[model samples]
Target: MQQPVRIAPSILSADFANLGAEVRAVDAAGADYIHIDVMDGHFVPNLTIGPMVVQALRPHSAKVFDVHLMISPVDNFVTAFAKAGADIITVHPEAGAHTHRTLQLIRSLGKKAGVALNPATPVSVLDYIMDDVDMILVMSVNPGFGGQSFINSQKDKIRAIRQRIDAVTAGTSRVIDLEVDGGINAEMAPVAISAGADVLVAGTATFQGGPEAYADNIRRLRGPLV
Candidate 1:
């Protein structure tokens, strides 16, 4: 069965000048999770916030802190992010020397572990770590920058991962969320959901028009099918 649609407003597009207020507003506006994009210039093309920002924003919202770490040597910072109050820590396979060990380390810290797949990354990588992952983030756009266009080719990747997750968790109680990030707006959200994305990470779509329009943006992203 398909999971209920969840809206995770990305803080990357939030008003950085008043991030705490932005987080709080989105939380109150029906955001299911607070998505934080942590990037290192080495792993990704751009450099973004670090664990300190996450810790600072921790008190702003009580919702699940879905932290996506786009950094190399990800193992070194797992403990930091977990201690910083990240409910879910997502890392890319290319960022670590051993993705399996990385996931184990995250789960050991009592944080839900997830694997993020870049636009060009292959789904075969998940074959070894599917059971260990709590979520699978498919980057619909190239990672690093925000407000980029969605890569239509990724819909096929999303569908493949969804089928793999379903097969692995067929009859058990395992719940692995299929998340789609990048280029997600009200218009493109439904296409990703149709391809089996349960969690929608929208930066521009959710934070645009300020706080007043957040609720409506989320409702539109959730769509009538939801």
Candidate 2:
């Protein structure tokens, strides 16, 4: 059976002061996962949340905590986030010297592992680790900040990666979620979906009008993919 499309609201653009309430609001608004972007300034020129914050927000919602680490030296922080209640941990392959080891560490900690490819990073890097992860995150825009424009060229790349994941996981019970982050909105939802993305990550588009608008925004973002 095909997996249902998911709308994950990125909290990078949410109100940080009331984070727990914000998380609950989004979960109530129908978010499949709560996407937390962890930046270390050194990796992408911006700094954001840590495990302490994640641990605090864990009880606010039972939705999947999709943690995307945009920090360098990714391996050093895997354990911390995993213990902080992150259900899914994703790291950029270029962020560490040993990508395979990082994935292993995440899985060893009992969390779903994922590898995120930047807009310029080719899918070939996943050749050996394709089956090692539970998800493939395609950055539709460069990581760092929220509300960036989507890279048009990534549509084909998304399709290519989806095809590759299918090929590698053939005849197995393994299911790799294909997620696209950055610049995702209702209008672009179908594009990403048709290109084979099952999860859509949006920040500004999701939290723009505050919690009250979340339901309609998420509804529009889900489009006809239900």
Candidate 3:
């Protein structure tokens, strides 16, 4: 049987001063994981939080830390982030030269390894590493920024990746999670989920309002049929 979709609220849009409070709110709201976007100015255009932030928030969060590393030289930092309490470390396919090795490193650290694909990146890039990963992140919009419009072209990509994962994992105990990130709001959540995304990452949708409303938005996004 297929598992129900999980909602991971990205804290990139939260008020930095009240980060711990924000995590607590999501926890109370029943968030499955706390998505942290780690951006280095080189790999992506913008820079965001890193391992230090993850470490600081660890004590406050009982949920998983789904750390999306949008940085170059991700291999050098994967262990640091994992040590800082990242439950899952998702590295971008466009981030660096060593893709498979990076995933291996994440696994060596005893954390779930995930590979993220940009909108233009083909699912074929995952051909060799699919079996090694625990999750595949499909970007619905360009990285480096939040609140961007969802790229409609991503629907087909999501479906294609889903098919690939299913085909490869058939009759095996291993299950790879299809995760959709960027521009994931209540309106678009269902479409992404319907395309076989088991995890939905939302930033603006969850942090735009106060905790109660944000939590409600999460519930609404996870509404039946999505």
TM per candidate: 0.98, 0.98, 0.97
* lDDT for residue 125 in candidate 3, whole number 0-100: 95
lDDT of each: 0.93, 0.93, 0.89
Candidate 3 lDDT, 113-176, residue by residue in tens: 9999999998789878877899999989989999998999999999998889888888878878
Question: How far out, in Å, is residue 131 in model 3?
Answer: 1.2
Give per-residue CA lDDT, model 2, range 104-204, as digits (tens): 99999999999999999998898899868999999999999888999999999999998887887788887999999988998888999989999999988
Clashing pairs in 1: none
lDDT (tens digit, per residue) of candidate 1 on 53-107: 9999999999999999999889999999999999999999999899999999999
Clashes of each: 0, 0, 0
Best by lDDT: 1
Off by over 4 Å in 2: none
- 1 or 3: which has the higher lDDT? 1
The lowest-lDDT stretch of 10 consecutive residues in candidate 1 is 217-226
C-alpha root-mean-square deviation, candidate 3? 1.1
| Candidate 3: stretches off by over 4 Å | none
